[model samples]
Target chain A: MDPVREVEGRAYPFGLKNVDTDIIIPAHWLKTISREGLGEGAFEALRKDENNVFDRPEFAGAPIIVAGDNFGCGSSREHAAWALLDMGVKAVIAPSFSDIFSGNAFKNGILTVALPQEAIDRLMEVAETDPISIDLENQTVTTPFQDRFTFEIDPFRKHCLMEGLDEVGLTLERDSAIAGYEARQTGEMPWYAKGTALSA
Target chain B: MASKPRTLYEKIWDAHLVERREDGTCLIYIDRHLVHEVTSPQAFEALRLSGRKVRRPELTLAVPDHNLPTTARLDEKGHRIPIADPQSAQQLAALESNAPEFGIRYFGATDIHQGIVHVVGPELGFSLPGATIVCGDSHTSCHGGIGALAFGIGTSEVEHVLASQTLLLTQSKTMEVRVEGELSPGVTPKDLILHIIGTIGTAGGTGHVIEYRGKVFEEMSIEGRLTVCNMSIEGGARAGLVAPDEKTFAYLKGREYAPKGEDWDRAVAYWKTLKTDEGASFDKSVVIDAATVEPTVTWGTSPEDTVSIGGEVPAPESFADPSKQKAAQASLNYMGLQPGQKMSDIEVQNVFIGSCTNSRIEDLRAAAEVLKGRSKAPGVKWAIVVPGSGLVKKQAEEEGLDKIFIEAGLEWREPGCSACLGMNPDKVPPEERCASTSNRNFVGRQGPGARTHLVSPAMAAAAAVTGKLTDVRELR
Candidate 1:
């Protein structure tokens, strides 16, 4: 994962609510073991229209998406996040997001900015012709028109995004704590670990 | 004062906590991990690239469900049939090899035990009360019905769990969805959940874990509870749970992965303690009259766009908010529905009676009861019943449910999430409306240009017989 401090670029002002993962990448494109090349199929259903924002010339390769409430509401497919990143999307601004999608976005170094609908409406307005900026350290989304909106994020997630930390490695670093817990579980709840040995 | 009463979720969270940081991020251990084909290839590939072996292989179980074809997998000569789609074949092959290489137990496509990961977990007793289960699929919440703290994780988190057997997390606010009174006859668990999602919009339970409470849930069978919990994701909740009780213990006893002898007695003793204590508080609460729930079905693209079988399609202007109105209009357009049309009059060309949401033996029996002496209407071009797993299929056959479906002109197919999503060959044709028992009525969920009306198994059977979205109660 690359460290994400600031993202600034033209935004696709797609304010559609309840945008699910099936629409983000669709089940047909889930066949590949590889994560690359998914941008081609990203929003394939929505891209059918020539006037679709994702396919329009002005928003091509846009780094941000200004969307409506409940963005990424269904499915736990990280491919939705992977597809966004593959299409050069660095951030998504919505009134709200599904919990799983938000977590997936953070893991893949994509900034998910949640603001009030009024702010999202304003951002959608400014995003039509100008680029928007998201500053993770400041927790703010700003447009050139002096419109600024502050957002809330988990302190831990914010730290990881700024540093590009590998979560697995960090968890592994606390090996002693994990081992200690396991040692206690063996005596307290033996059945929990008994199945593993039988399988082995 | 007595110790602060805790919610079922809190008890599970405390039991699984391994470490906590100053920022409230807790490293919680995962007891069971379920894996499927669609979302796991990349995670396994990442493990290979990083040279990290699975930390606890026995805790993980892998199976192929999303992309496996539901057709026969063997020929007259008993050789394996090759998957037609090359990409899907490669993905399935990857899991077949990856699981063993990483020392994880896997049930192959042809294995009798193989099924939808969510369905496989509970039936095999891998999902237990007070356990923390995670999978790379949204419906992992299905296991929560058995009182486990199970929720879905993305592939990156999938890799994290595979490598560490733990997840870094913050606690979610708890909600109680209490449905008092007995559900009226003909209103199945599917209808109850659909009605709940209708009451609470798709994003109603966002950022919270819902604990289902009240007489309605307490009386529901484990299978019914699983059916209700399976769609918690569709309602925008991280997970949904029902407290473990005698029913839960009865469902798990003597199962393959369940504890034996003294362990079973001890496990039950602990599980009995997994309920919410009196005076326990919830961050939010919703109460619904179970008697008010009808034979519900989704009217449009979103699961929240639901109506009772006797209701009429709502006009976009009926929605109070501008955005919701626009969404309603768009949904009507996509569903090819008229604003004032009767829901029971909506015609369907196909019928699908299976998915992780409604493919258990009890579900099969429900559909069979509706179709016992009837045949699908001639106008219904295609109908199929795909069991959740091979074991479910065999069980249904033993109970003569397969004969009932086949006699009703419905295809009794092998199980593996068939027709639930468009990932496999079982798809509803373009422009066709389907009465489906699967979760999600999203655009193109069944196939491109396919319009799906979500319903219960009995309702799906009713639709097959009538060639329209008819109420199961009406058939009686």
Candidate 2:
């Protein structure tokens, strides 16, 4: 799922707001749960018009999607992120993401690159015709003309994404912390103690 | 030896807290993995690509409802047309194909049990009280109605849960949202939540877990409780929970996944302590008068942009915050509605009374009761009822609720998350207006250019009969 950690690539910007998951992979496409066949269905509605973004050859393989504020809202369907990923979108630069959508993106190793609307607007302008490069380690997005745009990401999310650690991997790292917490909770909060015959 | 404090949420949170990190994210374990067709494909593929099997296949339950078509493919507005595109067929096929391979118990299109995941999971009892459930669907929090610490997980999280049934997360602060007093006739849980959202505004519950307490919640039915908690996210709450009691146990008894005879008492014991303590504290509190909560509906895009049936859409200038002026104007324009218009005058082309948020047997019965023997209003193009679950559909039909709907000029359809953005078959056409029982009214939420007003089922029926939004209480 960790396709790439460092975002040193071109950003393709689709500046739509409140992009619900269904539009990402229309429910019409949800009849099957396979991944390979999804590319055909990704942005099917948008592709219906000959003049839409996906049909334009120049933006065909855009890596960065610049969405409007509150993008990816509604229904916690995670396929929305998968469709973007499968369509070759490595990062989504939006003012904000739905709480659920952001989590899904993180788990899938997709960077939910939240940037200030002003900063995103600038990238959107540059990305429309020119490729913009994002550097995760340095937290900057640089253009061919050497213009630099910096963004903020949750440091821990950055660390996990950089290290390609999924939740399991992250959890294993805290095995000791979990063990300690359990020991303390059992002794102090006996009534809260679980996993005995209670679940019988 | 000092011990840690335990609240019901904390106890559940702690048991599931697999690991704690220096940065405050907790890698927590998920006990039950409820899968829906909508978000499982990628995760299934990830499992395949990684050469992994489901860590606990038996603990996983799967169902496909969001994307199923209620009617064969049609171009009619508001009617659920089957998805005929090849790609859609492929997506559904993949889920059907992969489910058996993983040994996950799955309910499909023709399955008598197929329905919205939130509805099926709790009814099936897989999401038992005190258990931790995670699904790749947001309304996963609907399972919280049973007092489980259930929340929506994403596909990557789905893969994470599959490999180890755990998640890394930051915990939310606790907030007690208490609604007291008795609701008047014509009011329902849908209205109650609408009223709460309107009062608290959409962002009121941000960063918090709302625990519904007090007399109103106590008197609610399992279905009613589910409706309130279902839209907690719209209120910006991370999740919402209700403490389990006899009402909860009664709902679980004899369910497919609930404890059988020998396991019942022990199960109840574990469930009893899931309640908050007498002196326990919450980071915040919001109290409401249940008695005053009338049949409510949304006049604006956000759930918070709601008012009582008799109220008017607020003018942009009425908003104390100048920044809200643009949004008010945009909502007024997009909805094809005017500010200061009495909600009673808002015309509706369709009334859809089903979704994960509403569409329970009780919700259907309520709408049917209002629509009984009444013909749909002229110019009201469509009126349909899509029950949330197969079980609800079965019970409603047996009770003759379907006949009432039909007699009153409404089409009754099979169970699914119909018209709730889980699928497109039931969407309202762009530019048309619909009074929907679904949870959201975001732009294009129902369909492109579709203006949606969220309402209770009875209110929806009222709108269907009047061809415009009207006070349900007047008809009652």
Model number with the top lDDT: 1
Give stretches of model 1 more than 4 Å off.
A196-200
On TM-score, the leading prediction is 1
**Model 2 DockQ class:** acceptable
C-alpha local distance difference test of each model? 0.92, 0.77
lDDT of 1 by residue, A98-155 (tens): 9999999999999999999999989888999999999999999988989888999999
Supply candidate 2's per-residue lDDT for A68: 72
Displacement of the residue A198 alpha carbon in candidate 1, Å:
4.6
| Span of 10 residues, lowest total lDDT, candidate 1 chain B | B254-263
Q: To one decimal, what is the Cα RMSD in angstroms of model 1 from the true structure?
A: 1.1
